[model samples]
Target: MTKEEAPVLLEVRGLAAKAGSAQILKGIDFTVRAGEVHAIMGPNGSGKSTLSKVLAGHPAYEVTAGTARFDGQDLLAMAAEDRARAGFFLSFQYPVEVPGVANAQFLRLAYNSIQGARGRDELDPLEFDDYVREKMKLLEMAPAFLDRSLNTGFSGGEKKRNEILQMALLEPRLAFLDETDSGLDIDALRVVANGVNTLRNDDNAVVLVTHYQRLLNYIVPDYVHVMDGGRLVKTGGKELAIELEARGYDWIQKSAA
Candidate 1:
């Protein structure tokens, strides 16, 4: 089926949000259908990241107006953990470092929690070990990573890979990845991008929040959106990203003016 024919995974209309007293998202309308990759691109403080945080039900942001429906249900009304249980996943740009938790333990608990919520059988430690290791291989991550503290002392690349590994294990229906390409070397970028690509299928969708077109070269988004002044100003095909790279965002600002 074509993208337009696919089922709508997320729909937003007049989405306005704020962090504390500052309004971020301003009257945004967006949609995502299954089997598509969408890239939200903009300069610093354009609300690209804020959009994802709001959809994921982050506590810091308040939805002042508009509606967000995920899989035909009220998204803003659901709790953050409930959003995850309903197949909504958001990868943080900065993966937090949990000092005492082993990476494997963290992954297993998260996987089992979601599984139980879905009424699927929860895997025990041994069962989950085998399952997660297979997922880790997709990211080319070493087994040693499972034993280390979650994101603690991990290099930038390792942390990103760990985040993707979580995505692989949970297999979210809709993933909102925030600045996933930041601070990665070339090799790491390819590995992480490859992992994301491998996880893609006609049954799911990915929404990427990024600043540069370089990530698009690997992920190949079906649609590219440019945001400015807390609103989505323009949207085009993958080639729009190429234009942004060459000409800069100045024209976008002028055109929207």
Candidate 2:
């Protein structure tokens, strides 16, 4: 059986959301099962990012209406921390830079925090370093990066690779990478996509929110869903992504209607 035939990990029905007074998502609907790599594609300001934020449980975007459940539990009912502990991960488009926090230290704290929440043993700094370094090797990142401040004085590719490193360590059941391809050159894009592809499995699901089809070339998606006018307008296989690349999103709006 395919990912669709597998158990559903996420279910969004009639999802409506807003940023302050301006409404964004309008009755959006979709379902993602375990083992699926779903690509959410659309034009700028088409509520693509908004949908990812809403699903990630961002405080700035309010869920005005609708229901979303993850692993049969209520998603909106859980706190952000709870969501993370429950195996939800979101890699930001623009990974933040911290001047004082070392990458290793930050990752350790985050890892241990989630471990504590899950009633698992927290790794010591030395143990975590060993574990994290092994994971970093998958992304072809150097050990020197661990000593630096988080994303500080790093290239765009380094920042994105760091995000994927965190995802590898967390091993989230549902991972949503928002605009991960933004500002990346071909080399960086391939490296980041390789990391993402490595993490995908038959038991976990990934949702990649991207604008361009170039990223899809490196990481083929099991499903492509188009977002326009604050709602999911179309769903198809990877072919839809290739078509979107050839014809552009303007062709989707008519099909969206």
Candidate 3:
């Protein structure tokens, strides 16, 4: 079967979400099939991040209407942790710093938890150390990263790289990276993009939420979607990003209006 014929990994229809009585997503209808890379680009506060968070079962957002199904399971019904265990991942734009937790401890626990959920054998620290270190190398991460506290005292690029490292280890079936390209220098961006590109396969899909077209240059999304006013206004192939980059969102927003 071709990539277009791959199984649907995520399906959303009429999805609306609100945070503290402020309605954010008006109506979102999206679908991602296995093996496709999709990008969501929009202005600030266009609900791009909210859409990812809501789909990932963030507690702050309440689903007021519609449905989201992932891998034939009801995604909204799953808890945040359950969603993660179910092979759904959301890489936050601003990864939180865990002051006391060592990166190795955190990654291993997350990896083993998902492994056990999938009825796979859980790796012990030593075994996991070997496995994870190999995965870290894909992101050009040093061994010292395992010893540092998670996201603590790390540069912006380092934090982003760490996020991609977590992604590599988890190997989620559907990953929604929210503005992962933010705050990274060119070299760092290239590394992160390489890691993401290497992880892509016929069985997994990625949805990137970003503001700049620069990220698209490296990732090369199969589909480029323009989100405006909490809804996806337009969608096209990779060339659409180049057009949006040059023409700006004003015309798109106005046209959508």
Cα deviation of 119 in candidate 2 (Å)? 2.5
Best by lDDT: 1
Query: How close to the true structure is residue 159 of candidate 1, measured as C-alpha lDDT?
Result: 87
Residue-by-residue lDDT tens digits, candidate 1, 36-72: 9999999999999899999999999999999999999
Candidate 2 lands at a TM-score of 0.96
Tens digits of lDDT, candidate 2, 1-257: 75558999999999999999999999988888999889999999999888877888889988889999999999998888888889999998888899999999999999998889889999999999899999998988999999999999988878888999999999899999999888788888888888889899888999999998889888888899999999889999999999999999988898667
Q: lDDT (CA) for every model shown? A: 0.94, 0.90, 0.94
Runs of candidate 1 exceeding 4 Å displacement: none
Provide TM-scores for the models: 0.99, 0.96, 0.98
Clashes of 2: 0
For model 1, the local distance difference test gives 0.94
**Residue 139 in candidate 1, Cα distance off native in Å:** 0.3
lDDT of 2 at 107: 97
